[model samples]
Target chain A: MRAVEPEIVVVDYGAGNLRSVAKALERLGASPRVTSDPRALLRARGVVLPGVGSSGTAMAALEERRLVEPLRELMARGTPFFGVCLGMQLLFQTSEEDPRPCLGILPGRVRRLPGGLKVPHMGWNQVALLRPHPVFQDVPSGSEFYFVHSYYGEPADASLALGTTDYGVTFCSAVARGNLVATQFHPEKSGPTGLRLYENFLRLLVLEEARPLPWR
Target chain B: MLAKRIIPCLDVDAGRVVKGVRFLDHRDAGDPVELAAFYDREGADEVVFYDISASAQGRGIMRDVVARTAEQLFIPLAVGGGLRTVQDMRLMLKAGADKVSINTAAVQNPDLIGQGAAAFGRQCIVLGMDTLRVPGSSPPRWEVRTHTGRGGGRPTGLDAVEWAVRAVELGAGEIVVNSMDADGTQQGYDLDLLRAVSRAVSVPVVASGGAGDLEHLYQAIALGEADAVLAASIFHFRLYSIAQAKEYLAQRGVPVRRVPVPSGDR
Candidate 1:
């Protein structure tokens, strides 16, 4: 069966960097629609929750848009969801920066990186692939991805980690469990290497769409 | 495994690339678009365009320059100087700058950092601090300066290292600590200043100002632990090519991205 191009829904919770993320997706030939509507997110074949701000504000925005429950349901239904930076952190149970709790999709606490190594780990750093995953299909094992974050998600399950990076110590940079894929790094800002990853994501979207209806 | 970065800093004034002797004396460097393209081809990991002109005329010029440079350069471009509002940052990003750096504006309104980070992801915001070494101390204290190293009214009085840590906490993803004392010296990096800031922040620290040669670049990464090094005279004058600098660093056990040379050249 010929694969249908997947429509990408970029969750716009008022705090995410939607423009660049959408531009990157469009470059990969994926139809991207930046929307706050939970229905659009539910209907889309793939969801990209691209965030850039604080955990508290992000959570508030998601809750305000009423996307929290729908997103959880989408994840449970095996929708291909990719989160970047704060979007990735929001997948956890809670964050130290904000008092409010997170989605509790991933079991972990997002805490600040220890002092002396810098607060926001910015710029491009190398990603060491831990396990084979579709998102990193064509990407090399030690490919560099741009990262900018202060706190990182410490997922309770080690098996969920797909890649790890070292700043002061080895920390999870990308995570994958079943159909959910998220990266702490901003693949949109990571140049050609990053663009390639997005392209690979589009390919994954094609595969997900080609699967039998019952499985999908 | 952190990949080393090659960054080229363009001093923009009235929308033109300007180079100076001590960050005070100014001379036209080149068109930002042309220079950015040159650096991109020469294997620059990233490019920074510092708007040296804070005047109304300079702002207009910077907007045009940013648009032009962003069109040609595919790598990350960080634009700074005179960014005071969300609009200022928005203008630059819309004009093609991937990241926006704030120095004076950030000091004036500390919340601007968080606001900008929130508006444009933290990865797209940079805090550029102009630091000076205050004499007569065991560790030699570093202090933040503003207004092109001119009148900022008694400095911010914040410790440079501590301020960097706080800046990151406030949502600044990268820190560029430019040493006023080392500016235009072309001797070496202000190791003391670089080390203190690097030790304080976990994010990538870019050492700007006094880089004279390949050794200086190597020292900044090795001794100063800088993730990236920014220089003006060396690259602006064609004293060293980006590939040559990377080659020198690679020989010294410093990990750098290997740019494939042309087959004929090989």
Candidate 2:
């Protein structure tokens, strides 16, 4: 008997290193479909919204593909969703980089990181866990993760913050609200600790699949 | 606090790592992929593959090396050397380079910086600056050189500090300050140049081309104000392992990431 890998949909908004995210997922034994297709996302066991573009461009790309509503609905419907960097930023309603409105999935706004340090905050930084989430399973406290961002998520509800990191001041680096998990750092590019995060998220999807749904 | 990154640079020429680093794990240091995996296990914060492949024939091999290394590395992989077009940037990013450093081409065409930043966020578009102290300039000006800091072409006459500030304005997310005169000296970094550029630009500045000891690394961060220090000979020769460097930095209050050491070595 052959084991089955979950079909994780890597959203391609025409921005972001989708190939890198997909390759990372593949390395973890999951079949990831890189697509802008709403239908693929609708049936996806997990959705990874990865980005490396300005918020305006990423939103415009999603709007161009008519995926704005579908994406919001998918995340709202409790799919194992993951957002990274600008992907995490776009989950909020607005950004300092651009005036364009985002998905507004999470009740927050993306603000520029503290300028007292490097604007990009590019390099390895450690995150201190405020609360345990499934995503950080097997990850050590203060394990370094690679980061490259000018902005970070400022969730309106501070309770949603799962982890906090410091650039100049302490800010939310990872957030968890139900099954939707997002990180200010690129876990995919963060080495073994990063791969462990992906593996943990995959296990969450597998667990969700194994759960006995009330409807079923 | 953000931990200072210790990045070991691999110079790839004709599809092989040319630095000749003999690792206890990997048999061939020339194999970029194997060496990358070894570094990954060694607790390296990131790995930079400086592709020195100048020929068209070597481009295919370069991409293959990047793909295989990317497959194994979970850390940020930065690629540079002869990336002239947006397509070249896209190909490497798709092949798994977390960032693309454009040096010579960026100098020839300044718009490439903005175009890259617009197409693929500024985070991945690194402006690699090779510098040289001009012979007869007031205020001790440093000029930008391309083609791996060869130092004999159509001189732009753009001051290094001004070039860095302008590059940031042009959407460059990061700046790598490589001193051509100090490239192989291993004396120490050009602190005056680094402090000037770091003060001029808000983006992270990576100090490259000169590093002989652990003190050089700490000084690059503490005195030079560099966000990261890029070294080749020091790391390749095992003069200091990433773990040891981080421990030393941590002891000196430099805030370096502690790369976990192998049990047997302990």
Candidate 3:
């Protein structure tokens, strides 16, 4: 018996750490296609934008690969989308780290952590759940997730934030709006709790929706 | 608040995890991939794999070990030792390592740090500093010693604190200060050295080497002001489990990740 390949596309724009994300998906029995082609993204039952690095370079790479427009279109079409680390930052309008406009899919600004604190808020930190969401099912409200970034996103709409974490400031650590989901921490790198989040996202939003109706 | 990290470093040689006393006389610990999985399950905040192999052949095995470890292990994995170029760092990151630590190579070629940060964000690059105390200095200064174990130990003549600042300027996101004087002795971390570097750089400082008990781990974070503590022997020899170490720290009011023990484990 052959296993069907998962129609999940992990966006690759020359950023590092994509392999870890892909491997996590594979562990959950998904043969995720790591591609930068916008067409592949459009056809995916779910799209995962996983990135690490500065916004300047990440945005440049996305623009160069011709993925910006397609990503916007995918979100508009209500496809299940998940963003990790800088991928989540790019959804906002601007970043203080770099003087460039982001995808602007969501309204917000990415700003640096307050001075005197460690630049990269590296290590495990608790994510306090803002509301009940299926993506965080079984994962406790104060569960710690691995975070490695200097800048954090501040969405104009506070209600958009699904989870918040405190370093020097209490900021949005995870965001959800309809079909779009994103996290500042790397769930792929965050032990078993992290794997559960991925599983929940895949099962609830991606796989469950993709299942054919019983009548069909 | 960010939980203080407890990292268990695996000194790997020829694809096997081996621990050395003062970087001499190695003893086999176990297979790299299996030991890594064990640590991940036991609740290590992050795992570091320092490839101590002398040959290119041994380096080749690390990629496979890392790839396999990434498949099952869900924590951040850092690979160090012998990574000199941006391409080398890329090989590790592409092999599923979340971060790459550089020691000897970073000192020899400082630009390697900047180039790595430019290529793969500063967060991906870690500056591993091995320091030795000067015989007699009024202020107790230490110098950076590169290639510091087994046919290595070349002095760079740069002050440890000064060099840490320079590395951060050159784009190292985190600094791991390993005290050569205290490495295998496990007397305690070189508190003076760690405090100096931790205060000098705005980036997070990781205390490495010389952790004999849970108290040493506590001192590294409480007094030394280190963002994280990296120890090899204590956790490696099973004198204390990662959970026990975190519990000890938490008792003292140190914010440590208290990972809930999954049912049927331990």
Which wins on TM-score, candidate 2 or candidate 3? 3
TM-score of 2: 0.93
Cα lDDT of model 2 by residue, B1-266, tens digit: 77778888999888988866866554786788987877888788888989887787787788888988887677889999989999999888888888999988998999999999877888889999988889877676898876652445446677899999999999999999998767789999988888889999988899997899999998999999998899988888888888788888899999877665432243
Task: Name the candidate that leads on lDDT.
Answer: 3
**Model 1: residues with Cα > 4 Å off, grouped in runs:** A1-5, A212-216, B19-43, B57-61, B64-75, B90-99, B106-125, B131-145, B149-174, B196-204, B257-266
> What are the models' TM-scores?
0.82, 0.93, 0.94
Runs of candidate 2 with Cα error greater than 4 angstroms are: A1-4, A212-216, B136-139, B148-155, B260-266
Model 3: residues >4 Å from true position, as ranges? A1-6, A206-216, B20-29, B261-266
Give TM-scores of the second chain, every candidate.
Answer: 0.91, 0.94, 0.94
Q: CA shift at A151, candidate 2, in angstroms?
A: 1.5
- TM-score: model 3 vs. ground truth: 0.94
Cα shift from native, residue B245, model 2 (Å) = 1.6
Worst 10 residues of 3 chain B by lDDT: B20-29
User: Candidate 3 clashing pairs?
Assistant: B147-B153
